[model samples]
Target chain A: MKQNSLFLDRATIVSPHVNGWDEFLASLNCQDVISFEEDWRAQLESLPMRSRRRLSPQILLAISVAEKIHETLPKETAWVFASSVGEGETLNVILDALGTPEKAIQPLRFQNSVHNAASGQWTIAAGVKCPVTSINAHNYTVGAGFLKASMQIKSENCPVGLVLYDAPLPYPLSASHKINIPLGVGFALKPEPSANTIAELKISYCKTPNPMPFASLPQIPENSYNPILAVFPLLKCLAGSPQEDIFLGLNKDYGLCIKVKQL
Target chain B: MLQHPRTNNCGITHSSIVTCLGYGRSSHLLALREGRSGLSNNHGLDLQFDCYLGKVPDVEGIGFPSRVADFDNRATRLALAALVTDGFEQAVLKIRNRWGADRCGIVLGTSTSGVEMLEKTYKAIPENGAMPEDYSTRHHDNLHAITTFLQEYLGFTGPGYTISTACSSSAKALVDACQLVESGLCDAVLTGGVDSLCMTSLYGFESLELMSKVPCRPCDASRDGLSIGEAAAFMIVERDADGYLKLSGYGESSDGTSMSTPPPDGSGASQAIKAALERANLTPNDIDYVNLHGTATIVNDSTEAKAVETAVYRSVPASSVKGAIGHTLGAAGAAEAVFCQYALEDEVIPGNTGLIDLDPALLPNVSESCRNGQLRHVISNSFGFGGSNCALVLSR
Candidate 1:
């Protein structure tokens, strides 16, 4: 990896466990047990009703996180959206529709079924025409997204908005698909340190026989399976005290190591 | 800080493709040279519509290497078929040996990775119970299945992922590959895209009323819509390597206009095209030929025409191979990149194969027939659903 470090200018998480980044950090360290609820739907009140109805939970969660980050992001920030199975809920509906004799599918649902649905919808809604990409990296989605976003920050010299989300598949499909919870994380990565910088991150890639275990937040139960939370350990580090280097496995032989320093 | 000027160091040493036009570079070249269409009447899906399709013949029967046979699907099979062709596998092995597996990354693009298998599995789902015994989501349904399967089969585990930006997926994958090498992240990258035809896209496009009953005639006055095709194209890109073709530059942009269409002025497309030319440090005049992303849909053709006009500031010889290969969606970008590579090598301008009466609005830009020419730099445009636009500049 290059020596140039990325600063987390703005970071947030959308999940059933926490409402805001501050609360997430506080809950992580709090000894009292906290019960978290899903409030993403209520947050969608700001969007048009048509979008709210048509968007699957995955897209809605992604857009919600993006909207939160957009408040603090630069005007020219590029976006990199990552998910293991984008719009899986929409796909399940389409599959079910296709299996029927009528084989009728809604035009809106069909249009929103592409993997870039969240990126497309968010960009269109925000009227931001910068460079945007959507990624699907399976188990390594978060690491892959961070690497892609960091590379853009390094090469293009532009702040990049990174959003990663994963929602459970519907019904019998869910049995096959591993993720069972709706979760998302967003970060605005800048090439240089800024006033809003949460941490300075140095990213590198290496091959190791044993990958580091995923970091978990005490507030959320069974949080390791969701792909988006792969960065939770890094988030935990950013939320509180910085500690050991975090390794994000890209594949069997190689992975990305993120060394963070609290700013 | 000065913006990093895009580099032209990544060279494509070897590439392979499996399109409806047939397998390998030679087959596509012959078809492009003759202005022949590979599209035929749609088969197998039993759709209510009457559109043609650019289906690769007998992809289902293609077998996989036994070691990774568990990950077998039509898309991966199609990829393997192309991977072994044109010595692409041998070339990849050479690169892998020279630069360890960890140094060789894979970035693939696909709109429908293994959706066909997913559709099949969905159909075979036991009534109210679980999925069939053999269904594997990781191997057969996920968008990353193609890259995952290839890595498992070929024995490389570098930083790899799948980019799915509709039609621009593979083209963007190419851009990511270039960035990986330029950023010193990897020594060599396997970049390309694969998409197999499935019921989802067919019926989905049909739902949107974008399915052309007849073979697509992009840039033609009476152009109706697009014919969905299936293809897999792969390439080995290395930094500052000795090769006939180099990825000179690339630009990606979002329309931020609509999920299904671009704005009338084509501002988003123009941005990508202009960015590509600027990154390449070339004037519009430097571009020898243009591979138009002419999907035959009326709005797409006219807007793309204006976008090209706005960016190039001149009328350049341009054609859309969609008429020949059909709209390959995610694979279209990489497939067209290979087409651009051949154009650079053979000095031939691919014809707008399905054009009969050119839309007067486009005027003089759209080529009706394949022609030979002196070529240096060419641009391939891929604009996908969700207003995703990507332009790639390739040079010899």
Candidate 2:
């Protein structure tokens, strides 16, 4: 197979229970499936001189995780940010505003309601003017984001950063769909093989119902709403078996085949 | 920096259009030729402001197949309307059988995914004091609605997703689709955009005071603001080198500027144009025409004019079809690209519809009259809020 590979030099994961890859590594050693918890407002206080009310939870958590990945990552590099259900908290506010016809719509919140708000904020905050792809593909969002970044790495022959984040939606919207834990994953990728290369990735995208399902994250439900979970299989391949080809079903028919190799 | 602006084995093998001018390419091209506009008074839109709107009529009258009734929405309806025309659906079927269903992907762009349905639900919420039992925003307002619907509709299981970068969504979708093909993730992709008119945008643009009272006038000296519009446009982009038209290059950039205001001096826009041309490995002189992202706003027209001036040195025939179709926002990228596809095949350069009193500051390249000529290469620009910008180069 002539599939291209990208070096994953640095990475980070943020959830309620886990802080970074080191924590994940610890959890793997202990064989524990920990629950996630975090004080979003406190973590976001790290960023300077920004109002929080205008920003949604997804954008805040996303930027926070991205900031942790690379404090001074080049803004000129391309970015791919993906989510399954974005800004559900603000959606509830919007619906409340709609309920009160007299209540004025918060112009700032309304403008940032679009799916790409996080990407825009990342660019504006970093003051880097470059290409950005904001995606939302239901449960397939994380996989879609990775596929896009992998393609971009091959096309641009440059390093690309991927941020996949989503927060639990407040009910009654949550009644039908529930994502118990809010999670985010950040990855720094490059085209050329390097010392930081974590794996020789042979990634493929297609689905004729590949019966092989990669083992799911221990604590995470099989049908979790967290799009970030899509990358778990890759992480599993990294933390456990790093020399086998594993297939993960992104959806009913769409799947990702990643051959992971340890550094 | 980029070698040959992205080598590609794909081109626009088939396409379809559904806008205020009605369905199909002929209807759209005729308006482009005659400068006939689809923009009319925004009376029924329930807005107090005086604004012109280009809205596709009979959206409610259009019917989806019963099997896919659950996916019915204004945006999907518009997409199906186009998918059924120009043999687009037939082409998709033929390709699926040849390449296998899992070998194709569906990527769509939209600013208001199903927000219109949300607007309807919210309108009823105040009266009912609770969400309607049937109020399901999953199919109507979810960001993945169109992508999921198309995947289910086509029965294809390839990589599918939706991109929403305001007006630049669909243009970026094409870029994403091209990558999918280049990465061997998929063999063929249905790439385009669909955004149905809703109060969210109608009042949203009005709130920003970006909507014009009269019809939009692109590049016009007195151009004040934009005339908002809605449409659905798609092109069956495949990894086939046989098509006459070729998608040579694409460039993407961000202004990192304010959400509403574009970067002054055209630096952000120029970057994208330069990137596309750089990848195409051609100088500005090689471009035969430019499809401007001319939304008729005083700032957009002047800024884009300055950008075109800096990007293309020669006086290539340049125009903005937004004056005819109104600014189709998310779909405008693919819409303008489709217009360019027909322009290349017909060898006719469409005049800037609403560009009457061309800005004197703009070099004399901006044309107001349509002309017949041999066309080789053309580029379409789509820039949007959040400082998202994109440019596409297609050649014949």
> Candidate 2's residue-wise lDDT over A1-263, tens digit each?
13667677667777766677788777752123234433443156434655555677788878877776655344457888888777777776666665564444567766676778887877777775778878888767777787778887778876778888888766555543455567888887777666666656667654534344534444544444465675776776677644356565556776666777667
Q: Tell me the tens digit of each residue's lDDT in model 1 across A95-169.
A: 999989978989999989999999999998888788899998898898889889988887678888899988777
Candidate 2 chain A minimal-lDDT segment of 10 residues: A29-38
What is each model's TM-score for chain A?
0.90, 0.86
Shift in Å, residue B256, candidate 2:
2.1
* Residue B116, model 1: Cα distance from true site in angstroms: 0.5
After superposition, the stretches of candidate 1 with alpha carbons farther than 4 Å from their true spots are A29-42, A209-211, A215-224, B1-4
Per-residue CA lDDT of model 2 for B115-184, tens digit only, reads 7777776676444365566765557788788878888888887778898888999998988777777667
Q: Number of backbone collisions per candidate, in order? A: 0, 7
Give per-residue CA lDDT, model 1, range B106-220, as digits (tens): 9999998988988888898777878776678899889999999989877886789999999999999999999899888888999999998889999999999999999999999
Model 2: how far is A214 from its true place, Å? 7.2
TM-score for each of the candidates: 0.96, 0.93
